[model samples]
Target chain A: MTHASLALESALRQVAAEIDAQFDRLLDVPDDPRADLYRAMRHAAIGGGKRLRPLLVFATAQLFAVDKSCAARVATALECIHVYSLIHDDLPAMDDDDLRRGKPTVHKAFDEATAILAGDCLHDLAFELLAHEATHADPFVRVELISELARSSGPAGMAGGQMMDLEAEKASFDLATVTRLQALKTGALISCAVECGAILGRVPHEGRTGLRGYARDIGLAFQIVDDILDAEGDEALVGKKLGKDGAAGKETFLSLLGIDRAREQARMLVDQAIAHLHAFGPEADLLRDVARFTLERDR
Target chain B: MTHASLALESALRQVAAEIDAQFDRLLDVPDDPRADLYRAMRHAAIGGGKRLRPLLVFATAQLFAVDKSCAARVATALECIHVYSLIHDDLPAMDDDDLRRGKPTVHKAFDEATAILAGDCLHDLAFELLAHEATHADPFVRVELISELARSSGPAGMAGGQMMDLEAEKASFDLATVTRLQALKTGALISCAVECGAILGRVPHEGRTGLRGYARDIGLAFQIVDDILDAEGDEALVGKKLGKDGAAGKETFLSLLGIDRAREQARMLVDQAIAHLHAFGPEADLLRDVARFTLERDR
Candidate 1:
């Protein structure tokens, strides 16, 4: 394996371990009637995934020389948002998927009602984690983090993207429309992860321009690669049912550009994403490596 | 009408109008494909209700000489949380209710998937509103508001209460368990509306104890009256299906104590709630009126 691939693998594992421990500590179910709900939340949050968003948070925070504990809190909050979205998206009325991260989805493992409440509770807890003093010493920073996360994850962000995706399944979308949908659905949260780390590190507006650029490029690449995987990748390795987009006739980068062109586009975006980090020295090596890994990752 | 009731009536009308307008402005569906999701959010948020939580926020903030705009924003945020909860609770998997506020529930008006997304988006927008500068001049106050709202609405609060209530359907609950369930499910967000107003007003910790006590008493009384309404209220006036708790054999205050005793308990709680404000003068007259209104309100 290349040095960057090895480094990326090690960093991903480290952040995943840190975030898992944080979620376990944060999501302890009390011995009460609501223990079931707590258990459901724990099942959804603490259970496995790539932990890519949290890794971005930790990696970007490292660039700013931010403390590990603070980054862990932010990463955990981001993961909560991501997990809640997945749980909701898997509902019978939504994607209706029975599997997530290679296990029964929340609604499948628990009851649908429990799954809905657990998702709602997890969403609330994400903000709670960000608002805590332990997340950051400065109230301004905490509020900023909350604002950015909320915006990115709200109507014009992930939810909006999902809505667009639902519409896309019914109608063929052009390249621009598909790009916008991908940007909102998956790109927004990914960008927020990086921006949050930058915020925690007190990266100024000028410094953030490059990071934002990096996030945008990688965000699209991430989604394009996702489209590629959904079309052709192994379901076991992907940890989810693949080819659903094609089955549903959903317009994705892969549908719009075909696999070969989509692959070329993702590679171009990753290179451009890496270019954005050129202004930083070796401090952004992990981010650069992660950008490359996005194209190479099977899941 | 008595002077206090008349004053509260006017204040409620004014704030409800203000909040309705604010929600309309904030929830505008852009001219895009995701406009349907935005429409669902608008329908859930702007549709008819008592706007009681927003009224509490405005009334409590009035005591602190806080700006009306700031209070309005906080009130709007609180309303978002309240409406989001209602949307989720009315889901087919949860309460399976078709009606809310004299209109079709969000899921009925839109679809179940849209309803879930709308609720999720509103939940995010609540934090976004609280974190905005328009919510407060002080970032510390905003962070505190976010933290308090998150805690009140999360696992240990509203979500936990809902879980307990769901469990109550399967097994009988005693008076204490019922009270605890009501406190977490309904009381937390109601109390949060008052507490957030106090925070924006910069109420001292000592000053807040009375408010907290007042909130706790009123919260119980609010739920007791809800039980009473479910058992006795006109379906049209109540604006939703009634007696579902009894139908589901869910344990409630009315079920535990009978109608007469439950009404008596609610009255006693209301009087006690009023007693918490004895230290303040007529500035608290509106709060006292609201506590009384909780019992007298048919819907």
Candidate 2:
């Protein structure tokens, strides 16, 4: 592997460890009936996924030399939202997936009620962590973080995107429609992760255009690659049910453009994402690598 | 009715109208797949219920002569959290209720996935509303409101209480256990509404003890009255199916204390709740009436 890719990989692991440790300390299990709820949250949140959102937070925060501990808390907050969405998404009323990270889904591991409450709790935890004075010395920064996360994940963003995805099963969606759906669903939070670090660094909103552009491009590429993997990747590697979109007759990039063109589209997005970071020096090499890693990841 | 009770009645309508108006404007539907999601949210959020939380907020905010618009926004934010919990709690995986507030539940009105997304979105919207600058001039006040709502609604508060309530179906709960369950479940958010008004008024932590006590007593009394209504209130008047607690074999204030004692306990708590506001003179008349109205409410 190239040195840049290796650095990205190491950072991924490090962020995952940081997030896991934070969640461990944050979600200390009390001896009560809520213990099961906490356990279910830990089951879904503690040690899974690519930790891509947290990685983005750390990478962008690093660009501004924001304090590591502060960034860590913010990163963890983003992951909590990401993980909470996954738990709710995997509910029986939604995806009905039994396996996530090769382990039983929260509802399957615990009960459906516990799964629901765990998701709700994690969502609340995300805001709580962001609003905490410890997340930033300035309350304005903290409120901004909370608002950004709220906007990105609420009805107009991630959850809205999921709503569109569910609707896609019944209606044919053109590429524009699909793009809008993807942007709201996965793209919004992914972009917010990058913006949060800049916010923590006290970067003004106007200064964040390039970073926002970079985040949007890579978000699309990452999602396109996700579709590609779902269509062709190994189940053992993916760690969850795959090819369900095709089976459910959902409209996705892969279905619209086919494998070859979808892969090509992802490649172009990665390049465009990197180009958006042209103003930065070697300090941005990790971000450039992250865009590349988006299309290259197997899971 | 007495003058105080008449004043309480007028404020309830005003708060409900204000809350409904805010939700109506906030959830303006766009023409897309998410239109259904937004519609579901509107159906659940824009109307119905007693608007108890919002009333609590406005009443308490009135104590410090807080700006009405600011109090309205905070009250709306609290209602968003309250409504989101109701949406999730009514889902098939949870209470599985078909009706809420005399109408079909969100899951019944829309698809299950849409209902889930609506609930998730509403939860996100709560923090979004709180973090907005219009909620408070001071960012510190905004962050405090966010954190407070997050804590009360999260696992250790309402959701945590929900988990315990779910567990109660399998295990017999004693009086103390039932009290704890009610405190966390129904009590936390109710208390939060009162505290939020204090927070908005910038009431310091130490000065909030009496308000906190008032909120807690009323929260308990509110739950007892809920249990009482569920046992004997008319279905048409109550607006939802009643007596599910008995069918579910859930241990409640009624089950542990029985009807006569439960009634007596609720009366005592209402008296105590008013006593918590003893230092406040005539300005606290509405609050005292609200405490009295808790046990007197038939729905």
Candidate 3:
């Protein structure tokens, strides 16, 4: 591996460890009936997945020299949202997946009711973290962070995208429709992670243009890569069921563009994503690596 | 009816109209697949229920002369959390109720996926509303409101209570366990509505003691009344299934304390709730009425 890959890998490892520790300290099991809910939450959120969202927040926050503790808190909040989405998505009513992160899903391990409550609890915890003063000394900054996270994750953003994706199995979506769906489902939160970092750094709205562009491009590339993986990647490496879209006869980037063309599209988008970072110096080296990593990641 | 009951009735009518108008404006159906999600949210949230949570906020905020529009937004946010909880609680994996507020539940009106997404989106919108400057001019006030709402609505509060309530179906709970469960589930948000009003009014910690006490008493009274209604209320009057707790063999206040005793307990609690308003003058008249309404409400 190149030095850049090594740097990204090390950062990923560090973030996963930090996030696990934070969740551990935050979600202690009480000697009450709610213990099962906490356990389900810990099961789903504590030790799992790529931790890509948190890594994006940290990488972007590093560019502005934001405090590590503040960045860590923000990262944890992002992870909370991401993990909660995963828990809800894995429910029997939704995707009906029995496994997540190579383990039994929350609904399968615990009952479906506990899983739903656990997901709902984690959802609230994300906003709670962002709204607190510990995330930022300036209440103005904290409020903005909360507002941005709320917008990206709400009906018009991430949830809207999920709604559209659920519709995709029924409706035949063209490239433009697929692009819009991917933008809402996966791109919104990915872009918000970078936007939140800018908010934490007190980057003015005008100052975020480049970062926003980078996030958007990489967000699309990330989805294209996801479609490719879902079509062709190994389930063991992916840590869940694969080719689900194909099995469901769903339209995906792979189905529309074919594997070779989808790969090319993702590559081009990643290159454009890196180009959006022209103004940043070596301080943004990690973000540049993230864009490339989006294309190169196997799962 | 007495003059005081007339006053409370007028206020309830006004607040219900205001809440419906506010929800109508906030949840417009977008011209996309997510339209179903927004429609489901509207079905669950608007044109239904007693709107008691918003009344609590308005009543409490009125005491300190907070801005009406500001109070209105906070009330809506609280309602969003309440409605979201109802949507999730009514899911097939949870209570599995088909009817709510005399209408089909979201999952029944739409599909389960849309219902889940609607609930999640509404959850996000609550924080989004609180975090926005339109809710309050003071960032300090806004952040505090968000934190409090997050705390009351999340795992350690409403959701945690819900988990315990689910457990109640399997395990035999005593009076204390039932009280704790009810406090977490129903009382937390009701209490939060009052507390949020205090926060919005910038009432100091020392000044809010009476209000907190009033809220706590009324919250429990509200649940005791619910237990009473569940055991004996008419299906048309209650607007949903009756005797669910007894049918499920779930332990409740009515199960522990007999009907005469439960009604007596609720009446005592209502009187206690009214006494907490001794520090305020006639401006607190509505709060006193709400406490009385708590015991009298059959639904």
Candidate 4:
């Protein structure tokens, strides 16, 4: 791997560790009857996957010299939200996936009731973490983080996107419709992660605009790569089912634009995403590297 | 009806109308592909229940001279949370009820997937409302409201209580255990409604203590009456299945204390609740009347 790629991998690992520890501390199973619920939550949240959302939070927060400790809490909350979404999305009533990250999905490992409750609890925990004083010393900044996260996760955002995706299975969708679907389904939270860091560091309005541009580009690039990976990458490496999108006849970026065009578009987005950070120096090296990594990662 | 009872009834009707109208305005089904999800959310939230939680919020906010407009927003959010809980709780995996407030449950009305997504979206909407500037002018107060609501709804609160209740069906539980379960499952949100109003009005710490006491008493009394109605009230009037608790052999206050004793306990708790509000005068008459109504409500 190149030096930049190695650095991104190390940073990702560090943030993953930080998030895992936080979840451990935040969700220690008590010696009570609810221990099973807590265990289900831990099973869903703690075990696996690339911690890309939290990495974005950390990398963006680093751009403003924000403390890692404060950023860690936000990262942890965002991951909780991300994981909860995955848990719910994999439910029998939703995707009906039995496998996640090469292991049994929460509903498969636990009961469907426990899986639902665990997802519900984690969603609550995410907001609770942000509302706590520990997230930021300034209450206004904390509220801003919450406001952005909520908007990104709510009906007009991630949930809305999911609803759209569920409907998409019934009929064909155009490129623009698909783009908007990815933006809300996946882009909103990614953009929120970047914006949250800026809120924490008190980035100026113009600087935030630039960061948002970077976030938007990388968010799309990330989804494009995701589609490419699902279409072509190894299932064992992906750690879940692959080609299901194509099998289900879902219109993904690759299906709409074809593999070569989709790969070209993702690379172009990564370059554009990197260009948005031209205002910063080496301070944003990790963010730049992450944008490039989005195009290359298999999972 | 007594004059106080008549006043309480009118006030309840008015607030219920206000909440229904607000939900209709807030959750208008967009002419989008996901309109079904929106419809499901509206079905769950718009046309149901006593609006008791919002009434508690309105009543409590009135004590501190909070603006009705601001209080209305909080009330809307609290009602959203309450309704979302009901939607999820009625899922086939949970309580599995087909009817709620004389209408088909969300999952029954829509598909289960839509019902789950609707509930998820409403939960997100509640926090989004709390984090919005319209909820409160002061960001700190908004954060506090979010924090309290998150805590009340999260694992250690509502969800945790639900886990315990799920476990309780398998094994017999004592009175104390049952009481704790009811407090966490039902009482937490009711108390949160009262506390949210106090937070909005900027009630002093000492003043909050009395309100908390009043809320705790009323919350318990409310649950006792629910148990009594479940055991004896007409299913038509109750608008849902009754005697399920007895059929399930779940230990409720009525099961433990018996009918006469449970009724007596509810009355005693209502008296104590009123005494806690003795510091206020006629301005708090609605709150006192509401507490009394808890013991007398048939549904």
Candidate 4: C-alpha lDDT = 0.89
The residue-by-residue lDDT of candidate 4 on A82-113, one tens digit each, is 99899889998888898888889999998888
lDDT of 2 by residue, A214-284 (tens): 99999999999899988998888789999999999988999999999999999999999999998899999
Question: Model 1, range B1-299, lDDT digits (tens) per residue?
Answer: 23347887898789879988999999887998899998998888885898989999988999889899999999999999999999999999999999999999999999999999999999999999999988887899999999999999988899889989889988888999999999999999989999998998998777898888889999999999999889888999889999898899888999899999999999999999999888889998989989998888888
Candidate 1 accuracy as lDDT: 0.91
- Candidate 3 structure quality by residue, lDDT tens digits, A65-154: 999999999989988888889899988788999888899999999999998999999999998998888999999999999999999998
Per-residue lDDT of B85 in model 4: 84
lDDT of 4 by residue, B36-98 (tens): 989998888887788889999999999889989888889998888888888888989888999
DockQ of 3: 0.93
Please give the ranking of all candidate structures by DockQ, highest first, separated by commas.
2, 3, 1, 4
Candidate 3 clashes between residue pairs 3 or more apart in a chain or in different chains: none
Q: Candidate 2 at A129: error in angstroms? A: 0.3
RMSD of 3: 1.3
**Residue-level error in angstroms, candidate 1, position B285:** 0.6
Model 2, position A257, has a per-residue lDDT of 96
Candidate 2, residue A211: Cα displacement in angstroms equals: 0.3
Whole-model Cα lDDT per candidate? Answer: 0.91, 0.92, 0.92, 0.89
